[model samples]
Target: MARLNVKPTRMELSNLKDRLALSTRGHKLLKDKQDELMRQFIVMIRKNNLLRDEVEAELIAAMQEFVVAKSLINESFIEELFVGTETNVELNIVEKNIMSVLVPEMNFTTSEAEVSSDVQYGYLNSSSELDEAIDRIETVLPKLLELSEIEKTCQLMADEIEKTRRRVNALEYRMIPQLQETIRYIQMKLEENERSAIVRMMKVKDMGD
Candidate 1:
């Protein structure tokens, strides 16, 4: 803890007293902000955990479907079918501001299934299982992206909350109290000097008389 360098003077002391009062008020308001941020951060953390679990489960299911599709269909046939099809996916990243934190936004064009043609290549036939797998993957992509955004946002909020809490503690427990103590000490010293000067002046007047 760094000690504050407060020069002891009447005007300086008055200023410090005012600063102490202001710091005390600021400390209270900061505490309230910290509490509110903590509450929101905790809620987001809980949601992040739940979303992570759900994403993991969905990913596992999607992988299983991919494996089944691969086993049921021939690789070369699938390759030929997709060769002329456009598989280029474009994703747009947007930003959302939450409590001065920027979070990620994911947006994409429609899935291949929604925009695919009815043409077939060689002896390849697009099965319902393949369509199901593609649909499920498409469904999970946006949710996974959302979960990622939420996790990052929660982390940022938690960090900010911790910083605010530290500042509040410093003002409340250290800075404000020290300033008040110094102000009291200065006031007492000033009063004692004033009383001593009055006594000295009275003695001189009595001697002159």
Candidate 2:
């Protein structure tokens, strides 16, 4: 590696050595952080995958039931049945840190102006299939929200891991090696100066004798 362009002095050598020590230490710490972030990222990704699959399957089943209910009922009545429906949703968003990366945590409380079920309209007017579909959708809503949180967390963690990897590589491959080379150069220069001083003293003694 190309050594740093610096004066080959003891002070410069001491400075370079200190820098090398810090760089190596920083590299170790960053590498550890990167590894932990990756581990957590993998776990979240797996959870996201599972949650996505479950949510999709549930939604599909709910849609199938809705279609069946639609076939049995009149279109206008279906719309009227759902008219004026209101659901109050309160979502709580917060951040949690994993390996210094901030990811979101989401929770929500939902209350309906109507009852939780379609029983408000009575069973005679509404088909069981419609009720089943609504229940399925309600059950999957929380899972969908959870899936969204995990996906966002995974995205943020991936970004942090990439940044940490770059820093670690820069320190390990570029900064540390350059400092070592510069320190060696300064040490060699100092050794040469010492040997020259010894030679001059010996020559003076011989002349004196």
Clashes of each: 0, 0
Please provide TM-scores, in order, for all candidate models, with all chains considered together.
Answer: 0.77, 0.91
User: Per-residue lDDT tens digits of candidate 1, residues 139-171?
Assistant: 777787779778778878878887897899888
Provide the global lDDT of candidate 1 against the true structure: 0.77
Report the number of the highest-lDDT candidate. Answer: 2
What value of lDDT does candidate 2 attain over all alpha carbons? 0.87
Clashing pairs for predicted structure model 1, backbone only: none
Q: Write the per-residue lDDT of candidate 2 for residues 1-209, one digit (tens) a residue.
A: 99999999898888888889999899999999988888888898998898899999999999999999999877777787777466777899999888788899999988864336434565556787898888898888889889989999999999999999999999989999899889988999999999999999999999999
Candidate 2 has its poorest 10 consecutive residues by lDDT at 113-122
